[model samples]
Target: MLELASNLGQAPKAEDLSKSPLSIRGLTVSYGQKPAVFSVDMTVEAGKMTAIIGPNGAGKSTMLKAALGIVPPVSGQVQVFGRSLDEQRARIAYVPQRASVDWDFPTRVIDVVLMGLYRELGLMGRVRAKHRATAMDCLARVGMGDFADRQIGQLSGGQQQRVFLARSLAQGADLYLLDEPFAGVDAATEKAIISVLKSLREAGKTVVVVHHDLATVNDYFDNVFLINTRKVAEGPVAEAFTAETLQNAYGGRLATAQVDQLAKALA
Candidate 1:
């Protein structure tokens, strides 16, 4: 139940924690000559579920990529746990969109999950028994323990997402950057994923997700960052999930008549 202003004040003021588990200031991203994200500033708390919601071309995914250092920012800075990306690499995990990977490649679910530990394995290293155990544990966390030997291409869209979730789990990170984790997932799979994310938050891991469905935003996240090229609004769900805010986010494109009717029904 915190506002953006209050949350900024409540955050640790020291340079050490003030840098945040994930922090962005005046962040912007450009693909060639076109700017995808405009100047934006935000902070993600440790052990909380934060959702970034916006329409297509709103730069939600771009902001996430910038945070992960996947897309270099044209301006501003991103700091993780008070350190630069290189220093904080081990403490962060990323679950990219399911469509981002080459599913046609022949690989087992466990093999993909084990890739999370490759950073620790070093170059030209083989998976050891300990790594196998860790990967199994991660699969179990996502309810995919029995599918360890299953081929990645054979899994359903939901199952594929769980596999990636397991991979992030295997990384043993304190911060998770998930891009569209719910896309194309069934309701049951979506609920299961939400449960896992809640558990992660309970375990003191920061989770930042790029989510598109506006109807489920309140139910799914503790904090919401409403973005459309820029940050329109951000804070706890109740305060930021207002008609005026939604209108601002959607602009004149919203069906005002339908919204009025819905508001009257609720009233």
Candidate 2:
């Protein structure tokens, strides 16, 4: 179900594999004097689902924002499909954490999903009937077609997450950058999102997620990027998602049982 690449090891220094779906080199981010991410480097291969896994405050979400050019990096470069993110904006879709969004915003579920097409619609272009149909189709893909006209605030946490996924799906992008899409969602929603991610890989699209659940990393993604302010390790899940690697990334903060379970899985 997952394709494992042989090159599973620590990220190289300043090497630019721009030809890859996503390439980050020497990326650094700081909040005033506090460094959030320190000279991180990573490469996301095309046609795979890559999980950025680390403990809290490991700069996982910050890295995703930098890749999308949403958060300005103090230094370093981000390349999407061998070009600057701005130049390849149309080829990318981003799903931010649901907590970051204001569910109380006066908007319909369909309207929110249609926002994905705004890039194609432009300021002057009308949405038209086809666009609405497309939006509804995206909702249906996520099992929310029946709630298209409902207010976004009316949906449960899982449904809201699903709606956001539908928006990204409507974008028709080559690469998707999701920031904690699994946070606070129900089990059913988690299952649905995983299915969607697998479908994207089958269609030859790349998906990178800022994920926190180390337990599910292997089950959901083929590739794993472990970071903690600085990159700790990155490669295939089988190779990089090891107890030693997790300890290095989490600073021995993981529970003993977790470490034991990870070791058993590797064995």
Candidate 3:
């Protein structure tokens, strides 16, 4: 059996740092000369769900990528569960935007999910019956069990998302980072996905998502990290998801009515 946390060979932690699931300091990302996200510092709450919200091009996705070492940043340090991200790779799971995937690739749903267990399977590609059963169970958890043998390109957008979530589930990771999981899906799919995420939180896992819908922020998340090229305000929904902070991040783009609705959501 795999250990939940890999042996990083680091000395003991100083109490508070060990409790932080994800931490980024002085994170800076750039697209050519322009900075995408700059000087951002965020510490995610353990055993909770957090949303990274900002207006278009505010670096919500970029920040996440940088922290995960997916997209290289100008400068930064990211720690996962009180250790360097590289030192704790197996403890993390990531799901990129659905649009970023290449559905046309010739592969069945099960193969994609099997990628999650690469570390466990090792070089000889020995996938035992137990591995197949574990993959199916993960698919079942995300409502994709029956589609394991189906072609990847044949599934609808929502179904595609669920399969990917199943893939992430197979990782058995302690921290999950998602990039706009709800971007283009229908309502029912969104509901199903959030239920799975909420269950993870209840089971002592940490989740961070790049979220766009302001209306559902309060209903769906325990904490919010608002950014617009830099950190705006980050804390619980009641504290950070406010009219003033919304204005600061979105400028005049967010309507007065939406801002008022956000205020009422906290009431």
Local accuracy by lDDT, each model? 0.83, 0.87, 0.88
Cα-based lDDT at residue 70, candidate 1: 81
lDDT per residue (tens digit) for residues 1-267 in model 1: 001322443456654444368877788888878788889888776677889887788899988887677888888677777666676699999999999989978999999999999888988898889999999999998889999999899999999999999999989999998999999998878988999999999998899999987767767788888888888898877777667777787787668984475344323
What would the TM-score be for candidate 2 when compared with the true structure?
0.93
Look at candidate 1 and give me any clashing residue pairs. Answer: none
After best superposition, candidate 2 residue 11: deviation in angstroms?
Answer: 21
Model 1 lowest lDDT segment of ten: 1-10
Better of 1 and 3 by TM-score: 3
Residue 209 C-alpha lDDT in model 1:
94
Pick out the ten consecutive residues of candidate 3 with the lowest summed lDDT.
Answer: 1-10
Residue-wise C-alpha lDDT for candidate 3, range 118-206, written one tens digit per residue: 87788887888999999999998888889999999999999888888888899999999999999888898899899999999999999
Model 3: residues with Cα > 4 Å off, grouped in runs: 1-15
Ranking of predictions according to lDDT: 3, 2, 1
Residue 100 in model 3: shift from native, Å?
Answer: 0.5
Query: Which window of 10 residues has the lowest lDDT sum in candidate 2?
Result: 1-10
Better of 2 and 3 by lDDT: 3
Predicted structure 2: lDDT: 0.87
Q: Which runs in model 1 stand beyond 4 Å of their true positions? A: 1-19, 257-267
